[model samples]
Target: MINAFMQARTGSTRLPNKVLKNLQGLPMFIQQAKRVQRAKLVDNLVIVTSTDESDDIIEQLCNENNLLCFRGSLSNVLSRYFHAELNYPCDAIVRITADCPVIDPELMDYVINSHLKNNNDYTSNCLVATYPDGLDIEVISKNALHNAYKYAEKPSELEHVTPYITSHPDKYRLQNIQSEQDLSAYRWTVDEPKDFELISSIYENLYVKKPNFNYQDILELLSHKPELNLLNPQIARNEGMVKSLKKDKEEGYE
Candidate 1:
């Protein structure tokens, strides 16, 4: 059984104290957790957060909800994940960020099932999904993470979590889950003021009627309101070192 690592925190340099922010009456982390918990493939969910003083509230929230939570290095995220693997009944780990409240459960099931069926060491679609900004999910074996903890030497590897494993295909099997639809224009992640506005706009238009709507529904809604996609033209970029290395090697840079 793979445990879902709902890695989250209260600290964000760009959007400080955003995770606890309410989205349509629910805390952002709770909304994210609710989505992941609805996924059929996840056996358990553990929210891995930082030990930062601000995150104490997160621990309290997890406790109140009876959801598993762990706190470790504020920046060294790999240690947080390592501790999660040690403490949980987790064969694999599903990486979910706190910022994305609109995470898709169907996408989560697709990636988790694919990872299990193909036996890939690590699997994700958002890396390639291009389904807009927030529909990313990472599933990886606990062993693969241990390998990353042992080998990936970069500072970002520890701070940024599983990029080292996902980027390095030579070290482990990697898979990309993508949607047939090009939802590349929607802004679903809450990183900047514009992003928050776009998300709030979605809720204003949809949440009153449908709270459990999927990614495709949101895409369709945003397509009708094209201006919503333009709220944040450039969301956060996924700069995986392994992916960067592959790109460099392909270009014969080294």
Candidate 2:
């Protein structure tokens, strides 16, 4: 069974409680979860959040919405993911973050299929980043996740789940899914207030017409209204990972 673990927390440094921010009357993460449920290949969807007291609301929100929730370490997200799998066993794990409210289920299934077909230790779309930032997906084998959990030492590796595995490619088989057209220029992730505005605008424009709007639908909408892209411009991708890497250097892990 393939379990998709969506890492979420209310303690975002960029935008605190950002996942709890509402989009179209529902909390942002719930909206993302709804989209993730549309993927046919994902046998189960689990919300993996830190056990910090601040995240009590996240668990309550999950319970209120009838979504599965697992609680683990607040700082070490790799530990959170590892323990989540221990509680809910699966053959492979799909890693997702709650910030991407506009994540594409079709894209997720595509990556999952590739992971299974290639029998890769790790498979993801973001390694080369052909897709938009918000559409990133990572499929990790049980063995790979276990190895990463046991061996990862750097602050960056521990904070972001797959960095250790990705860094040591020789130890694991890896595959990256690329889009035919380069769409990395677009950003649909919610990291700041401006990003939320762009996501809200996208949902306002597309969700009413098709609740299950794919990335293509978003692209089509953006094609006519290019101004939406300006809402959250100049923000770097994976800012959290960058910060963690800096911490790793400070701690002499680099």
Q: Model 2 TM-score?
A: 0.99
lDDT of each: 0.81, 0.94
Model 2 lDDT per residue over 103-130, tens place: 9999899999999999999999999989
Clashing pairs in 1: 125-177
Give, for candidate 2, the lowest lDDT window spanning 10 residues: 245-254
Candidate 1 local lDDT, 112-132, one digit each (tens): 899999999998876665677
For each candidate in turn, the TM-score is 0.90, 0.99
Overall local distance difference test of candidate 1: 0.81
Q: What C-alpha lDDT, on a 0 to 100 scale, does residue 75 get in candidate 2?
A: 86
